[model samples]
Target: MVGFLGTYQVSLDEKGRLNVPAKFKGLMDKQYDNPNLVVAVMPDKEGRKDREYLIAFPQEEWLVNEEKLSHLSGLDGDDRNKMREIYAQASECEVKSGKILIAQHQRERAGLKKEVTLVGMSKTFEIWATDRFEI
Candidate 1:
């Protein structure tokens, strides 16, 4: 697969649904087999440039990451705790009417109000609070 490049500025509706960019949606339809996508909360860590955001990826790709995380969790104590923390903060949803529903808790974690900033990474996309992104 190629990269999920570019940055998109969008908003969530009253129902907490944000539209996926057309190009990214096309990538999902054409390249990914999974209909559902997983939204995982990425917390801000010390020395990290990026702020707290949500990471969204197709189910299949997420599963691959999940498998690797599972393996790492088994061999290390610190990684095990981190893995559980990340998994616990994740939520799964599919694109409907061009939008993906961000779970309430996940939305709250990112302080995602109506306005949001969606950034496309190579393997996954990130959703950020509009104000937070500016900071």
Candidate 2:
């Protein structure tokens, strides 16, 4: 699968299914097959619960991240625990028919009701509520 790298707006239906943009789907075809994606809800560090969002990463990329974290040494125990917590909270999901499911908590935390913006960062994608973003 191609690395995540762009942004697109998508509509979130009542059931929480949202389309991954066509371009992103095209990009997926180039880099992966039977693409299994992972989703994680990350809250802002500054105590803004409403500022949380979901992050999706291609399985391969996630594995790389996992490896990097696994190899961490000489780090404080608290920092390592935090990383473990993040990884444990992530969910493994599949991209089907160009769409993915955002968990209810993830939707609510991000204030995603009817619409969402899917942004592709270098190695992962971020889900932001339409209202949380400025066009």
Candidate 3:
């Protein structure tokens, strides 16, 4: 892997599209070229509304995870229910011109409007709303 691996603050445009940090682009090129990537809007407890964060996973990786979930489907009962919840939130997105369009609901969920933070997470990357991560 390339040495350019970490997180950085980025800006989101009026259309909710975020630019990929240059360093991150190098890493992405080295790791993945798949046009399709999955951006998931996640929310945690405290009703914090995960609008500040966007989870990016390559479509291939998502598929691998999907396969794992598929295996769990065979298991009857509670396990299946849990996986169902996870699947319900997963969404597929395409990375074009190094930008990904964030869904409106996801933006609202994460409280992301304008500014965003791009975090590089080794295999994938994350986009966080500035307000939610003010330091």
Candidate 4:
């Protein structure tokens, strides 16, 4: 599969609900029987606050990654820490009426406001505050 491919401008409702782009939604439905997604705060390699964003992975895709993470040796501290951090902020959301409700903590971590943009990135998609999104 080519995976998700496109940039869609959207808005988050006051309650923190985001309307998934129709194309992305369609792809998810066609690719996975379960309409669930795992949303998490994307860590910035540069640790720049301005570059913060949230990433969403289809449930099946996330499960695949989780399976890999599960095999890591528990004796490795770094690996344990990394898994803890990733799982700590990850949220499982169900697509309902073409929308998903982003948790408040995830929204705040990404500095998401009213305007947001959804960028397709292969097996995942990203959510960025419109003002913070730069080509």
- Which number leads on TM-score? 4
lDDT (Cα, tens digit) per residue for candidate 1, span 17-98: 9999999898888888875799998988873424678999888889889887867745687887788778899988988867
Error (Å) of candidate 2 at residue 87 is: 2.8
Cα-based lDDT at residue 47, candidate 3 = 45
Say which prediction, candidate 3 or candidate 4, comes out ahead on TM-score: 4
**Candidate that would win on lDDT:** 4
On lDDT, who's better, 1 or 4? 4
Q: Estimate each model's TM-score.
A: 0.89, 0.82, 0.77, 0.92
Evaluation by TM-score, superior candidate among 1 and 3: 1
Error of 4 at 18 (Å): 0.9
Q: State each model's CA lDDT, in order.
A: 0.85, 0.77, 0.70, 0.90
Candidate 4 — which residues are off by over 4 angstroms?
none
Error of 3 at 101 (Å): 0.6
lDDT ranking of the models: 4, 1, 2, 3
lDDT of 2 by residue, 20-62 (tens): 8877777666776647688887878886877778888878777
Provide C-alpha RMSD values for all models, in order. Answer: 2.5, 2.7, 2.9, 1.3
Q: Which stretches of candidate 3 lie over 4 Å from their true place?
A: 2-4, 45-52, 74-81
Please give the distance, in angstroms, between residue 10's alpha carbon in candidate 4 and its true position after superposition.
Answer: 0.3
Candidate 1 minimal-lDDT segment of 10 residues? 44-53
Q: How much does candidate 3 score in TM-score?
A: 0.77
lDDT of 1: 0.85
Model 4, span 10-118: residue lDDT tens: 9899899999998899999898878889998877788787788998999989989899989877789988877887899999998999999999999888899999999
lDDT of 4: 0.90
